[model samples]
Target: MRLTLSNFVNYTSFMKFHYSILCILITFISYSQSVFDQDQVIEKTMSQRWELDDEDKNGTFKLTFYKPIFVLPARWSSNPNELPQSESLENSFTEVQNYDQVEAKFQLSLKTKLIQSFLFGHGDIWLGFTQLANWQVYNDPVSRPFRELNYEPELIVNFPMKVNLFGIDLRMAGLAFNHQSNGRDLPRSRSWNRIMFHAAFEKDNFQLYLKPWIRIESSDKDDNPAISEYIGRMEANAIYNKNKHSIYVIGKNSLDFDKNRGSLEINYLYSVKSNLRLHFQAFTGYGETLIDYNHKQTTLGIGISFIDW
Candidate 1:
């Protein structure tokens, strides 16, 4: 059954997820003061990570974290869309297979600076790539095949800024060309391109990112028409870091009130040692993966993630 936003709010499992996050948040807030310096943590982290500050900036190219990279040993889905569908008749699948409800999932992402001070010694050009994959490792009958994999490559021109709005500090802004695809043949191939705008903000130990994109229309028969309705035209990611723990909330919306559709993802990361950390994730909505762009599901995952905010 497709899980709608209205029904998801009352879902027992989703309620449990919400409660767990609430408890975690409360615990973190309680201990936030004695554990870390909020101002330094927030400012230094963002500045160093994005090279927003001109002082001590590296001119040479070097790879860095662009997104969270994690491996989920066990990820459970409430409704696995075994038979994927698409608006394009040629890309729709009718065969339904009995796939395991639990699987292994992982994401690998990295970015590198390509040009420093490209725009009047202000903007820097960067190249980034991210890959997300779902593996049916425990499903022996299926021979442990990969259920889905999405590849995203981007080119961004980022600039540093100092602006404040309603007590929130705007740190940076950028423009990017993004391409995402699942490299598969007809009946499975899914791909899209976008010209996305980026804006980042920070205050205390909280950081927020707003990204809204305009889809690049293709003349070829589109594999997933109207994908924006499910995957969203814009997304916002908010991260709060205190001590060794970080909480992330990501929301995507189609921007249509009449046919409202979107997704929400909550992630908690506890640093175990160095950059390695324990990761927990809960997601409810559509477009969990490129192949499942139009499908809806609720999922929970526990695993290990590398990197710290």
Candidate 2:
């Protein structure tokens, strides 16, 4: 069943989603140590991950998806993990494909400005959701599927500071209480508390951000994937703007040569009008394991994004 969700801010209010009904009720408290004097433009995206097949209920070679995230930043709210949605906000969902040893996801990202960003360092908080894909361990000659993590609610706390050259903006948060499968019919849940330090710098048309991510996954009964591990993620985005037409190129890499891998994309993001956007792009990279088998994709499309502020 598709769960419902609701918004949880009171300083300025609105509602979306149905997972929570009564509301989380968090008010915006002015920070005396805020680093800015003006509001920044709040950038947000409503997106989904769609795949070709559903996972098999019993143990089999089934295909599934990772979490489909709804990223709403806090110029819209002050609480973490409270991304609200409705049939009206956006209808963007990525298409997913599942293969025995490989899978693919096509992303349709939508953006909006629900709240005006405060200048300097305001609206640094964000909230989102996710469901891990079907990950399995098969040591036999024939490959069969086993359960990894099912689904989980995710939270984010980002402190977007002033962007400057030779300077880094630090952001950190935790992903608490996501679901996992334990052999039985019932599910086991776990939460990961993570803190990351990021260095951000941009020059001309290029933006570079480096993150040193640390993860601490708690165990329901002290198993292995429950310890803390550190991974390095480096992402770079370059944009070319010519009048009303623009291009965006992004490359993301993770130093964790194991389970978690990465991608590189080059696309065009343009404002067709005050309310319309045209997006087109193609990307080729690796998936869960880099360099084992190449991850290839070529998509040509256009969409409207970021209309309300």
Candidate 3:
């Protein structure tokens, strides 16, 4: 209790020794715990943020609902040409007309994994569906009719990987069967099918997907016969996430170097919440939609997106 010099020095030394022992015990506990949980630490580090689902971590069927894959309201093409002309239909009705100069365009996409660990314990199967619609919301003459609805369904088999390729991590690879159609009758009907092979690569905050597809030729049931001529046989999608913003560029080409026909789409997204993002999109070239398969145009729009690549 008395403030003596000798007593104060003894008390200080005792406290210092106690503090050193406590720190040594904490370090030993931390090291031992890390060694005991080595498997968990490796699993967490290897898990990818951009993968759809990991079968080893996420069990059988996981339903991800109301996930907005690509949602944007755009100002679409005005003079929508390349109307499908059929001999069975009247020629007068099939003539190209000037559509609403600035119509509203929107897309809603969703996906879920129906089966997981299908084969080899590493592959997962998933089914994805998306719909894109063009609305003449502001056009008084058309009475705000839905101009076109393009439906897409895909069956994908994804395999996760950890291979290093040219300084980037090869994260995933898969094969998919894809079908897209605009549910319409006679002259307006458009549909196509493809077998697609895709791979995903990531480096730091950037991710890339390379998808090359082969058109499933259907001569008798072909609705949009020349669709491949513009939409292309392969596509490359790249995404970068940094500073609460995600930027994407998607491009497709027919690989016909002589013709040089392709399409390009750019998207910029700002994260507004944990699950919501403000999306701005611009597209130029052909195949913006089923009806606009052969028509080339440039469009820009802004909306909300719920998911990222």
Candidate 4:
């Protein structure tokens, strides 16, 4: 019998000193370089070319990054499917355990044009994973193993249309791919390869985003009986900012596990300088089906990060 335990990551500037505010969680990127990386970033994404803080006024080439991660182990076995009490066939742990994961990613942004206005084409890359259970019995044939890997790419067109919103920003991404090496890598090499299309409405402290997506492959082929397991998906995230942080809630549904699930997260960005900042975040709640199984999970974690904050 084969068992697989998987983990995932969150990448953005929280980890890198470059690319200021980037926190992406997956891969497959096109790489190239140019000048005015900073000014070019604000311009292409804001529909206005920017100059340096003091010297140059031309949008030149620049680089940015986001490297923030939140992971907790011990909690791995604390999943909804865990055997809360000691049973005839199993022994339970005496207490709770804590664990963590690491994440890192970087981006190269340049100014490009679309529809007579300056637009942005950002290339992002990330890598990381969470820690799994260390308990010995977890390896027993009677138990299950889980694991996950995620990657995503997005394309954006930020236009100018503002009066009250977060300065009016809209973006579109091309695709998001997630590969899995479940404890057993069972049935086949299963995963979620999705083609994502989205649009967002942003005004300083508020963001309204909607996404319709589709997943083609998965680990537990028989897990999703009602949804074809590989079809249409939907998700939403709304944010509200007050002072130095943003509070947001997310809802998601799709062909993958935990179809009807919601999440709440808090993002804290503390500024140290005009160009440097620190980021921290926390997550809770559960996903209905993890890796196409009757699984439930609750996650809690803390991370030290760098960003444009």
Candidate 5:
């Protein structure tokens, strides 16, 4: 066949179109593979830890133990307030004024999935519980009494997704009904309930969680009416993992700059063994516990943390 001017023009156009399509396919495939590789890295890294409980396969009930679920012999808080005072009370538990400034802290935290791939195979149901206690073990005058205990329970529905926004991958979103309280009566009691919306984000070795909550009102049984003024309505947590060390920062704010009340907690963890980590934590702010919801304090503590969660 002999080539003409019109035929050569059409041939060039066809080649260009095919080349553009091939470039687009290559780009799409590269993006997909990158996402898949990242997901695999995260899953494998998390699977090696025993402290985390993973969801079961579709249409199954998975009950796994969340470890570092219990931390014993936690020590050090520069200041320990046995009874925190408010404007309503002239003196907060004056009887305990002689309480020791240093005591051991213990915590038990755990969670499990109740249902896997529920709601048209797009969501998961989970139950979680945590308890923290201050023990006067070294204070002989107190007979090693349990000074304070806060209990928390949560019901959560988590939906997983893969969406990238501004270089961050959104992994999951969830709603939770949470209740936290001190199991005490009258003047010593404190409790609150909230409906919270939470979401998870990740970029490289960094992960973040943002949770905002609305308080459920209890007309007659309101223990801490001004709790939100100090504890804030939203919380942000960030974690950075590298090599054998992980650092975490959690911040809460009332969203009112003028009032300016909230707290910040920083935690450092170093892997000491397969599932155990050396944990160092420092906190500055309000709502460290239910009883101290309105109190402001700075504390430092060191303990062992189970890294599986």
Candidate 6:
């Protein structure tokens, strides 16, 4: 074929028209797929919580809340495990420690993004830590001691995206390597490691989180070989907010019908002032703490919550 000015001009016009159409389609898809809305409470909450939609212009290195921070002055337990024991016979305690039925409880949690836009452009890597403690503050004879402390550290690779099912919006999904332990020596020591898969979804004033994990086996002695049977294989957390009132429900399941075991926790929060809220909590079942992973108990607590308002 021979090149000509007339033919070249016609071909160029056709290509330009198709390019315009492609651009319009891209714009439409982006707009329709958007899951964040500033006016929607749940959407906005999650957006700011995860920094999913550039809601926070601050750098990714800033520390933020990974879990609720709360202190309960009075926590009453229905059944207190007098003899804390582990699956490993050597890790079991022979003597029972003096503990109070009613004690103080608190938790602290924080997270920071270590890397933004790694692996894939949209994925972010974050490091998080949480500590929960049970205090024998009222045990006068025992001389005020910390009963149990659980430390949790996580490395997460989070990916934010937009997907809708029914009326719920799937906001983000991630994979995490989690380690939880009690920094105690000898028979008191307890720990576990897991690789977890997590997802977040929101609808109206409610937000839900799902996490399913698989235990990481180690060659060393297993402190709690039956941890999953008691603590659980998966967890579900739901939060609902309305004005100054918020309610949270956290549940865990072992995923085995033959020997089912799990835990349920309910928390109620009422905002009293700026970032300060009155909190009430109730929990039942196993795995309240690393030392109590196989122990079943029910507890009620009254306290104050900080941040994530």
lDDT leader: 1
Which segments of candidate 3 are over 4 A away from where they belong? Answer: 1-56, 65-71, 74-79, 82-93, 96-98
Best by TM-score: 1
Cα lDDT of model 2 by residue, 138-251, tens digit: 212224233233333333333333434355322222122222222222112222344454444434434444545454445444322312221124445554545455566666
Q: Evaluate all candidate structures by whole-model CA lDDT and list the values in order.
A: 0.85, 0.32, 0.70, 0.34, 0.70, 0.84
* TM-score head-to-head 1 vs 6, winner: 1
Worst 10 residues of 4 by lDDT: 25-34
After superposition, which runs of candidate 4 have C-alpha atoms over 4 Å from their true positions?
Answer: 1-148, 153-184, 187-190, 217-232, 241-243, 254-259, 269-280, 288-294
Off by over 4 Å in 2: 1-124, 128-154, 160-194, 202-206, 218-232, 239-242, 256-261, 288-309
Task: Compare candidates 1 and 2 on TM-score and give the better one.
Answer: 1
**What TM-score would candidate 6 get against the native?**
0.84
Clashing pairs in 1: none
Q: Estimate each model's TM-score.
A: 0.85, 0.37, 0.76, 0.43, 0.77, 0.84
Global lDDT of model 6: 0.84
For TM-score, candidate 3 versus 4, the one ahead is: 3
Error of 4 at 293 (Å): 7.2
Best of the two (3, 4) by lDDT = 3
lDDT of 5 by residue, 1-309 (tens): 699998898679668755874585456335434534432222222222211224424233444433233243546666677666643463246555456766667567666778766688778787888888877655756566777898889998888767898988887888999999889875677888999998877777787889999999886747788888999999998888876687889999998888989999888877654335677878899988877788888877777655323
- Per residue, candidate 3 scores C-alpha lDDT tens digits across 97-212 of 43675666656565567676667677777778788877765555545567789899998888888899889999889899999988887678878899999998878878788999
Model 4 per-residue lDDT tens digits across residues 145-166: 2333323233333333333434
Q: Distance from true position, residue 81, model 6, in Å?
A: 1.3
Report the Cα RMSD per candidate: 10.8, 19.0, 20.1, 12.9, 24.3, 23.5
